[model samples]
Target chain A: MNALIIEKTEDSPGVKFDPATAQLSLSGESRPENAGKFYNPLLEWITQFESILFWRKEQKMDQKPLVFAFRLDYFNSTSAKYIMDIILTLNKLADKGYPIRVEWYYDERDEDMLDAGKEFAEMVQIKFDFLPN
Target chain B: MRHFNNPVIKIGAHETGKPYFSHTKHQHLHFSQNIMQDNNSLNAYEVHKFMSKMDILVAFTGHFDHQMITILLKNIRGKLKTTSPEMAIEQKVYCILVECVENVSKYSSGNEDSSRNGMFMLCKSDTKYTVITGNPMLNKDIPSLKAKLENVSKMSREELKQLYRQQIMSERETENNAGLGIIDIALKSGNQFHYNFKPLTETTSFYHFQTEIEINS
Candidate 1:
């Protein structure tokens, strides 16, 4: 699968989802003027990844533990909804026998960010490894 | 220096063209007139002093857009980082500021075109920080807005979080009005907020929204 790499902007986050390495990450602030325009494509990519995972299963290819890292410093409410969508999508992927792990990195001083991660974790019923940066 | 024939002293303009005034019957017209004469040129020092007295750390009035909001957030981030003792409080304040200003840009009546007129101010007291925002909104939207505000204000923290999650997941939520932003604000500030809608006309009203966060320092 091709990697999805998007450079961060003043109001959007940097995204790098490498299928070969099985490491996906989003970092920086997210307060895009149009949250859907920025996030919908990423959600579609994840959905495509799910289809690829199914094809790999038919070929009996060993699945790697995919890690999705979220290192966001700040995100608006609208962006938060999209993040939740991303995680819930990942949760569905996990339910389909994909080995997925979510790593949530937040500033040690930003308890709100940490709490946001916790809320996502609880809402999706996923174990997120919270790391303070 | 255009004079009006009605003898009504124009203190300012409301909604751009409507004159708001002090009538000559109030007996303070002379003092107001004196200030108006001096107001031909604003005294920057006096304005600064007034802001300082009001404990206003930041204030802006006029048009707002995504680009302008980004610039304001950059400056606000720097200011909060320096003055706020804890990063948690700074992050909350910053988040709340973004919501307030973004709402201004998105929902202000003037935003029907490209012009988004609003007012924003961040003031600090000994124990809490207050954010104030005002914008003109269509009067027809007031009842629903008032109901939303009242409903959220009455909710508990946990209930607000639940509603936030539900709203985010609901398919009915739209790009422009998910109604999650206010829920987020209420959750962050613990519902320590107030809102008012003052009728500007039969078709429009000026909305004032203020939220407060206690300084945990």
Candidate 2:
């Protein structure tokens, strides 16, 4: 499986999915006018990566911890559901006994962003490391 | 109806006790027109005094477009950096502004005559920061808007958080609309919304929304 890198736009976040590093990360602001159009490909990529993770497991090369990270400063109101969808997708992998956790980073000054991470934690079983930067 | 010109639009009666207003006389005085036109009711003196009373830091009212969002964002960033400056509060204002303007821009009706588009005003006082945005919207959208506002306004903080999570899991999302604007606004602004609706026609109305975020000491 190859890595996927989506450059960040003014109103959309950048997505980085690396097969070799076994980590996927999203960073920057997200406020797409058409959120479904922006998130659909990312969703497809995640589904495809799940199979690749399974394939990597078959190859006996799955020693690294698979991780996901989100470092967002601002995201639109409409994008929350899509963020939740990302978590539910990651939760499926966590359910399969994979060592996986999400890294949610927020500025030390922004409590609302940090609070959002806590709320997300309540909704899913996946381990989320809420880091204050 | 909001417009007195169209007397059939049953507005000023107040007999039904509906929480609605009629902007019949001031329809021409909308933000867009007030910015451009001079013949109507608004004047620079009154606008200045009004903003001064609110302690406004930044304000804009115009057609909701991509270029306008960019310019407004830049201007807002500059203002936040200059006045009542705090990184946390600035971030909060920016986030809320994005949501509020997008709520107007993304949901604004296709009607050609409504002069309010993504009209946003940000004001600061000793205790809190206030954000107000107005949009011209379709009458068909009012029921859901009112329901959402009423539902969230009544919920406690914990209850709103729970409902937010529940909504994410159960709702089917689309491209243009995700139906989370009011919920996020409520959650971030302490679950309170100051909202008003003024009918223009039987089918069109102007939706005005105001939010306050307390400046943490």
Candidate 3:
């Protein structure tokens, strides 16, 4: 599967997904006027990546674990809901015995972001790390 | 300075604080006294008509429903369209409205019916336009809110940018109700935020906030 990479803009975040390394990173503010247009494709890419990994496992091929890192400074309420959706997807994949790690990077002063990470951590079964930047 | 005669000062029996005039009373007296002296000058009715024509209404209801916020934003934006054409000013107004509306939803610790709702008013002078939002807040929340305001007030434009960057870089996974958006509003307005908390009831207080953005000629 081809790698999915999107550069961040003033209004949206940058997303980088490497299928070979199974590393995905999203960084920046995400408060687009039309959030669905921006996030739907990213969610689709994740699903596709999971499918490829599942097929590889069925064929007895060795595959690396996936690591997803989130670094967001500010996100609106609408974007928050979309983020929950993404985390849940990852949790589902992890539940199926796939090795997945989620890292939530936040600033020390932004307690809100930290709390948000903790809230999401409680909901998902995957190993979640909260890193202070 | 404009001078007025026969100003009306009304205070409820329980109301205190040197008997200051309410905004509504001030407007009425300003028109009534000025109309008798200058017949052709703007009267209270004319001002009301103009304000109504301008489609500006400051609604203060003690209810923090999400639906009310949506309705308020739509109405305020509609009024701004008729009042000014500057995109920057319009954006400031939008930012202020969003911040105030969200603050009410996030805070306002009172009973359901008595929940401290806010008032939003639009006033324009010859060269500038203003949007003011006022709401009730708990007395205890004032200190932190004031400190945040003071901290932001001291920062310059570049400093505020740096502060914003640092804030983003150091954000934690969770946050308390720390009035972060108020900083954004101050940055956008290019002005110090005006705020005050006055004791209302024993368990509640009225918090007033005002900010103005210049409409460049």
Q: In candidate 1, what are the lDDT values of residues B1-217, reduced to their tens digit?
A: 3122223221335453433334344454333223222536445565555456446799888788778888888899999999988889889999999998988876688335534788898887767788888888877767877888899999999899898878877774568664788998998898988777767667877788888888874
Question: What is the CAPRI rating of model 2's predicted complex?
Answer: medium
Give the higher-lDDT candidate: 2 or 3: 2
- Which sections of candidate 2 miss by over 4 Å? B1-46, B113-116, B176-179
Q: What is the lDDT for B189 in model 2?
A: 80
What is the model-wide C-alpha lDDT for candidate 2?
0.73
Point out the worst 10-residue segment of candidate 2 chain A by lDDT. Answer: A56-65
Native A-B contacts reproduced, model 2: 0.76
Once fitted onto the true fold, the runs of candidate 3 whose alpha carbons sit more than 4 angstroms away are: A1-133, B1-60, B172-177
Q: Give TM per candidate.
A: 0.88, 0.82, 0.53
For DockQ, candidate 1 versus 2, the one ahead is 1
Best by lDDT: 1
Q: Which rank order by lDDT, best down to worst? A: 1, 2, 3
For candidate 2, the clash count comes to: 3
Over A10-125, each residue of candidate 2 has an lDDT whose tens digit, in order, gives 77899998988888899998877678888877777877877877877789874677788999987876677789888888888789866688899998878888988887888889
Deviating ranges (above 4 Å) for candidate 1: B1-41, B110-115
Among all windows of 10 consecutive residues in model 1 chain A, the one with the lowest summed lDDT is: A49-58
Clashing pairs in 1: none
